[model samples]
Target chain A: MPLAATLSSVPVVIDEEKCIAHKGCTVCVDVCPLDVLAIDMLKGKAFMKYDECWYCMPCETDCPTDAVRVSIPYLLR
Target chain B: MKTVEWSVDILVVGGGTAGPMAAVKAKERNPQLKVMLLEKANVKRSGAISMGMDGLNNAVVPGFATPEQYVKEITTANDGVVNQATVYAYAQHSYRTIQELDRWGVKFEKDETGDYAMRKVHHIGTYVLPMPEGHHMKKVLYRQLKQKRVEVTNRVIATRVLLDENGAAAGVMGFDCRSGDFIVIRAKAVILCCGAAGRLGLPTSGYLFGTYENPTNAGDGYAMAYHAGAELENLECYQINPLIKDYNGPSCAYVTGPFGGYTANNKGERFIECDYWSGQMMMEFYNELQSGNGPVFLKMNHLAEETIATIENILHTNERPSRGRFHEGRGTDYREKMVEMHISEIGFCSGHSASGVWVNEKGETSVKGLYAAGDMAAVPHNYMLGAFTYGWFCGENAADYIAETYPAGAKPVIDQTQIDLERARVEAPLLRTDGLPPAQVEYKLRRLVNDYLQPPKVTRKMEIGLERIQQVRADMEHMVAGNPHELMRAMEVYHIADCAEMAARASLFRKESRWGLYHYRVDYPQRNDAEWFVHCHVRKGADGEMEHLKRAVEPYIVELDDTEKSAYDRLRVKREPAIA
Candidate 1:
């Protein structure tokens, strides 16, 4: 199994109240260097694309609000 | 611990005009010698050429004037504060530097008479000729460096200079931006042509903004040299630009030509018209803004509806005579301009701080084996024109000295402990639990420095500002960084704190105001030239406390004719009225 698949099974939780619209958290947009999490301005938060997530944690680390939470699978836990 | 070691005869810290020329001179002196250049940013994007300004102030080609007349003009413009020896050296070598640039394949804009055009642009002193294709100058220098087989390491930030037991420069350690790898380069001689530290809390000058493109210039080389025990001169002297269109934006001044703009208070009254001196004009504007007439905008009178039409017509017709297209392209549409065309900030002709590291005639710092050139070194009384000229002289002299004193093929040991400490320091922000995000920290830092820590404000609330900055520095200590990019941001904050502290210390030490632009104390409004004409020097003590020392101004030897001195004095008296 690919690392993406193994990591995809984990839950991705985002706190919506903290997003500042800085656009620094767009980890999954087209032309993005990393495609871990796609940002939807309409949704006012980031949507996890589990299959393409590089597990780079750029979105989590760069989030100004500390709103991003990434949980790995049971073996890592 | 693993280490990577490299060796070179001469290591140039900056790849700007001075750096490349210095390396080339070293190679010319010895063909078999090895030269290495390290740049914090890309070489093409360094110095005055990066912003496409061809040449700074120089009296190269005679234009209805002689070199002696040009020297008097410079001294008069500088208000008799220029170092005569440095100015004379520049006057003599100005033609040679220009000729070298021509040989390097750089082109200059010519007049209709088929001769190179010269403008009376005031940079160093009175006249500075513009280079139309100065960007090509950077490219030509880079190509020459390649031809000389000089090794260049781009995107490498030189953290510190390594000194041997005798306090001589042995090598340098830097971190690579792309790979996030640390590099240790051993060199017998090091030339610091790294330019001025831009991170100090001051308004952006055209030269500074034109170089960095962004606000990331945190005075890295200044801090590095100061830490290595170099005597820093004139830390309080900062240049203020009268024509910053937007205070919060990335854009800088646009060329408004000879017809200058007017600065107004919030009440829409022209304030600068009351004062003729450029420094005084800026000081009055700053005072107005502080006294609740703020968010002030510079208005240009020439940018009227007629000007917009002229510009639009020029752009539409692609006319050569109309410089309007240049203005409009920079978003300077007269019709839809936010302010009336009557009010515009004067662009292009502005002053930079005429102070830096104190160096003698040979550009040698107090520390042996470590030399400073360009804006980073202080040659008393010299401005940008002298800076460029002294840059060449120092670069050539340092290169030759290195070639003679230190031979090629010498390798030095790497300090692994120092490398680990630097890495840990950079990574500390990442490990923090965090009181604030990096962006928030950056915002707070900029606001505190710009609003409260600047010159006009420093007079009123300096003690409070210093205390606030101390607290802010403590807050920055808690800033977290998780990635390499974030680590760089954290390091920027550290560097800014270092520069801000030095500036504040320098500000506190100078009891009386000497230079109108620098050391502006609201409490002490008078220029106490009798008591405070001495140069201010700041150095960090063993306990990390800043030590302040006052030294007498170095005397200048000027062999000026009676007519020249009389004309110079007359111009000095008239300077106040001309700017007013």
Candidate 2:
């Protein structure tokens, strides 16, 4: 399997309760290097494509609430 | 994940009063060293000296009192529960911090006698002291930073400290506010100077009080340190300012100076005369209001006259004031401004808690490479009044330690995954679909804590408050932020929930109450010095649960003079007469 395809199998969960509406954070929008994830302000959350997410946990660690949870494929028992 | 790298000798987070001084002092100690500062808010706006307050505490003036006297005063106020060694260190080095600010061109107010004017405010007993001129202090510090060529990254929030293989602080991980990019700063030493969390559902007026100024001080440093295995002290001891200005408008505290005013409830009864310690009286008033005697208004003798005069003055002069037409010469302009500024209003005053991450005499936490300063780090017996002093000591010590341990040219390793993780975490809020509005969550959280978890209300309905907060937390799980701004607001409310839970948990753990105003327990009416005289430590466990640890109180050895001793005794006796 390709590296991008392997990475895309990881699960990304967002905790909506922790999101504060400050238009400053666009990590998901910018860090997707692949531009797979975009911020939807109307929903006040991030939208990701199942095939597009690279399984990078940048969103999980940078979140102030530790709200984003990432589970790597195969690593999740 | 892509990696980005930068190196510095010293990294100071939250460049308020102490961060700048720490950076300046580090450069002063060794000019060849590189010092960097990162602040979440605009560096010009937060921290101890941020508001242009015209005075610092009395650690500067010569011959008025010694550092020993200052330590004695603090320990007395804290009821001997303070860490005496840390208190001494802060008091002793306070003069040096003030002098350093002055050397850096920070100006202070002068007296008619040509010496630095001193005030007897906020000190134990009758000790008078010199303070920096408030507004000019900021200008001086900023100019010094510019002159020193210190690298400052403003509007950047530090999310976590970088831990090396040895579990020592290697540097910090943060997100840039503007670009939404992750910036990993590698430094030999990291100083956590993030100010205390203030935005937690504390009842604050709608006006332009300082509490509303910096919403970013959500105890980030404290939470980060706790998660990293640092001990936090006295998390239950929250400071309540007695007088908040107008609920409808902006105002500062009027109780700081000698204001000739009386506090009355809705029944027009003078409640404050019963106890000089206004914190107690205010809490009692809240209880009365909860018991159905409230919607109380503080009738300021000066304010009433000032309002009438301002109305007449505006009417006579044809100069339309922004607020409204004012009367001429009917009242004191100072009084009118006081009301306009929201200085005399009474509400639940919450900003920086005097409690936080526990540190030793050297400002070292349990973690080796980690150090805390400002409102974020917890030092016993030090109140917000002494924040600059404590910040100075902690910052200076951290800088010196970093300089001695690691010289220039020390390469720090950058983790690309860590950067990626951090960025994703910060932006998660912006990805939610459907849930509660950020503002509504904020309102509900604040209302819950204010109504139930506040000291006065805490005693009556703590269990109910806890249940409500838990339910609220569950409900919060359904909250969604549609945009980056909304996500930031969501993060703020989430932070508040974390803080409120910690505070309520701490309050519930300590069954017996001590420290008259700080932890007031109506049920456990007396100060059980024998059983309850220990500092409470809160930390997150391996299971991600908050574990509580009780450490013995450090003995205060400072001897007071006969007169001072008498005064101290009198103040303690006067604190809680109703319960006694």
Candidate 3:
């Protein structure tokens, strides 16, 4: 079987400046129920790795630096 | 991947609402015993009440309601198909559960006298107890788990329940979401608190994760119990709520109804007298939505400013807090506009309706050494408080059972074949580099659920649904995952498929339409009480194929009068025929 990647806008947005992933912050990643957020080791920042988000928002509320913003997934919005 | 094994006295699957309570209460009962609470997500933010809840949907306060009254109400709401024992048991323990949570720093709305300020939301009872500051409910539960010294494991998806030689539940098997490490926990007993099969249906938004219940609850407990030979009851009576259109979270009539808000049709007229989420209420909501007065709305724009603000404060801060955000994105304001509402996709949830693993008053399932509670357990309209009350029951009961049956040094002899099969099934997707994506497969499967299984169901469509589901089951072989997280989703696909099959089979077996919209078959439009009044049960037969049977509805301890029995039938407000 062949596979192709599709591009779509993700619901959770992380502010790189305030993400503090370089300082070993994973609060957003740890709190997401869907486990959709991941820390990009290369960029040293938290990012939405998967589009599967419930938008339940522990990621945004629990973020220490207030770096995470959970927009209603585009389809829902 | 590697395998990590542990031995414990009790293993509680799912750390959401009931699992944590079960673990804590079990440890409290037998502090010497080793009890572990396993969660697919962090316990701090897991399950339906992950973000805390606005209020208890069914709180049996002393002055407001009695256990008998509560039992009668639930029996009527469930269309008279309840095992009154389980519901009565929850009602009896309801107050104590509330008091315990209150003692543990959980707050409830109170009168000037400091009694539980119960509000009337149901048709015949006052059960709604608001939790204005209930956002910290998880933190409160987490505190209790730590204080009780219950062991907690995070990110491990429990795929199957391991059975002992005696056909008893002995342990659990699965893998961690992040590490792909196979986890095997051997225990004297297991309590399943896995929540509703929320992901069983695809939302109108076309988003796979968008569902009324927390998307994490992929009906893992239901599938595990069925595979373990435990009977599941009334699965045909599916869970379908009136949620915010597109967003797929609740329109929250329970919260708004107490403050004079209601579900209205497009003409902004109240069609149903009550906003309680019963099958009957959903049927009326569905009818109004399909009629000329189409597209129901949660009417709060007519409320006072202070009342609206108070409602907003509670709604925005608690369960699915993102609800407020969704409303804002749509430019919906409680004062300016009525929140648009639509009937949600079908799923199995005993919390709202009676559809789950069968359990007695003691929280013991047909399979010994196995207990279930919370939304997954068949306690009709159990909701949040029932989950906690039943969690306490399962925890204490399982602890007692462990003390009596399994000796201190006793170890369950689990079949190696079970573990081997589960490992192969769990790890297959991770091994493939190129194949189907779990999300796409899940979307396709759930869309089939919406098409064939969504209620106002037809016999031919459901039969076709069974065929299509079998096709999807075969396609699951080609599902490939890129990482452990994707592996978790892939594994959930199997559970969802199992639930889908159970939903279809159970729907077919019942034959008659009951539970209003939950099991409204177009072919069998009339409710046939003579043959189908019994609780319809589904399980894995000796031949390893899905089996369906009817269990007698346990004799009702609190009988309803003829008038009361037909109370829910008159929910549709008689609109005086307009002047022609």
Which candidate leads the pack in DockQ? 3
Question: How high is the lDDT of residue B122 in model 2?
Answer: 39
What lDDT does the true structure give each of the candidates? 0.55, 0.57, 0.91
Tell me the tens digit of each residue's lDDT in model 2 across B1-580. 2234567877888777667766766666667768888876555444544444434534435655677877776665565677788778877766676666666665655668866556554335333333323444556777877877788877666777887766677788766544555578887777787766666544344211124323456667776787667777777776454332222211122222323344445554444433223333345545544554454444444555655453334222211111121111223244433332111221111223347778876778888768777666666434333455655555566667766666665554555676567666666655556667766667777777767776643555878887888888887766675544344455556666767777787887888865555677777767687877888888888898888988997766676565653343342222345664
Error of 2 at B353 (Å): 5.6
TM-score of chain A of each: 0.53, 0.57, 0.96
In Å, residue B247's CA in model 1 sits off its true spot by: 6.4
Evaluated on the second chain alone, the candidates' TM-scores are 0.79, 0.80, 0.99
lDDT of 1 by residue, B467-498 (tens): 77888888887777555445555666666676
Q: Worst 10-residue stretch by lDDT in candidate 2 chain B?
A: B318-327
Every model's TM-score: 0.72, 0.72, 0.99
Rank all candidate structures by their TM-score, best first, as comma-separated numbers. Answer: 3, 2, 1
Q: What tens-digit string does per-residue lDDT give for candidate 3 at B164-230?
A: 9999999999999999899999999999999999899888988888888899999999999999999
DockQ in order: 0.03, 0.02, 0.84
Q: What residue runs in model 3 are displaced by over 4 Å at the alpha carbon? A: none
Per-residue lDDT of A5-65 in model 2, one digit per residue for the tens? 1333435666667654345566544433223344667877765543322233344544665
Residue B373, candidate 3: how far off, in angstroms?
Answer: 0.7
Please state the CAPRI-style docking class of candidate 2. incorrect
CA shift at B389, candidate 3, in angstroms? 0.5
Error of 1 at B243 (Å): 2.6
Using TM-score as the measure, which candidate wins?
Answer: 3
